[model samples]
Target: MAHRDRISNLPEELLLKILSSLPAKDVAVTMVLSKRWKFLWTLVPRLEYDHSMYQDDVDGSSRFSRFVHSSLLLHEAPFLESLRLKLDHYSCAADIGVWVKTAVKRSVRELDIEINSPSLSTPVLLPWSLYSEGCKRLVTLKLSHTTLVDTSSSSPASFTSLKKLSLVHMKYPSQDLF
Candidate 1:
């Protein structure tokens, strides 16, 4: 069936439900299908931009980075309830921090960052300033598969609404995080 015919038959509620199931990036691209569906994305309440969806189990660095950029930069997502990210192995920790901070600044209730197979260097460690930027509204923060840095430069965000905090695959001295 043609694009117009198919969409014309579907109800607006159905379209919103289907778009809600997909990531913000996919929903943005769906807009090009027709003008009637252009603003359908704005009604979606949940936005999930998990980069792990691009994991090929063989090579994922380039693919994941591009996916992340597309989701964050190309979409029209507004005030997401939660931001879930799986940082690609080859990506710099600094970039991940930037993305998280952007989400928090937008009033995200839950921020989850999952890293897989991280790299280490003399000067390359988790960016501590991400938390120092003052994320008072963040309710839940989860950081996984990362190298926790010595946070001497700044302390963790006050995180007043934070109730469920989880850290996974975090490689750091016990005292560093304490």
Candidate 2:
């Protein structure tokens, strides 16, 4: 009699569903468990990037950027169901814009971004224009510590599908925010 790997024998769909419950980073590391899981992480529809998680590394910022870029480039989800980013001083507005655009392009339905720019006298402005008409599938939006640039003219339909919205310590450039 020989021992069999029951978990490995599980269907790919079942494995993916289980993987989805873990953090994105943990899911990625599962690749080292065996060859069978090498591509499983890429199929996950939910992604989360937190700068604080890599603060101990010397090149954390750059590595974080590379990770995000590569993840977005290699990800093969039909649509991103959720994306959460907790960025700090290391990230720039341009990079944030690019990532947001990429997520929106992938039809991310839920977006949660928290920018901790404590040192900045001026708030980092979020490229809300990227979503003015792009995120038609967005259902929930949560933002913190970032200023929203108003493009009110086209914003009414932007978050049309949005059911839950949370804004914490968010600044609006204009008094009117749609």
Candidate 3:
């Protein structure tokens, strides 16, 4: 009598569905389970990057940023269903912009980004690409503790597909920008 890995024998679609329910960190860990799952996590449609989880590391912010960049670069999903980023004070504006742009290119339907920066002087500015045609497929967008720059000049049709939008502690460049 021998033990068999029944779960591993499941179809890739089923495995992917299972993997999708796990956090991005856990999903990445699955790659080491076996060769069959080495590239499977890359196909998961949802990615959530929370910087707070890496706070224990010496250079947590940098490590977290690198992790996010690597994850997005390696992601192979044709259509990303969701992208969530929970960043702390040390998160950089450039990295945030890149993450959002990448998600938009992937046709992400749901986007949730929260930045916790205690200082009012260093506000993270989202990329203008977020208002481009690439974001036409976006259905839900949530942002916090960031600045929405140059929104006044953007076309009103930019967010036509958006059904839900949530903004908290967001800064606007001008009072009439809305």
**What TM-score does structure 2 among the candidates reach?**
0.82
Query: lDDT for each of the candidates?
Result: 0.64, 0.78, 0.83
- Residue-level error in angstroms, candidate 2, position 67: 0.9
TM-score of 3: 0.87
Task: Give the TM-score comparing model 1 with the true structure, all chains together.
Answer: 0.68
- TM values, all candidates: 0.68, 0.82, 0.87
Give all candidate RMSDs, comma-separated.
Answer: 4.8, 3.6, 2.9
The better-scoring model by TM-score among 1 and 3 is 3
Model 3 lDDT-worst window of ten: 148-157
Per lDDT, the best of the predicted structures is 3
Q: Give per-residue lDDT, candidate 1, residue 98.
A: 64
lDDT (10s digit) by residue, model 3, range 139-165: 999998888766455355378699999
How much lDDT does candidate 2 score? Answer: 0.78
Per-residue alpha-carbon lDDT of candidate 1 for residues 9-86, written as tens digits (9 for 90 to 100):
698768877877887668767766667877676665456665556554365346666666655654445565777776
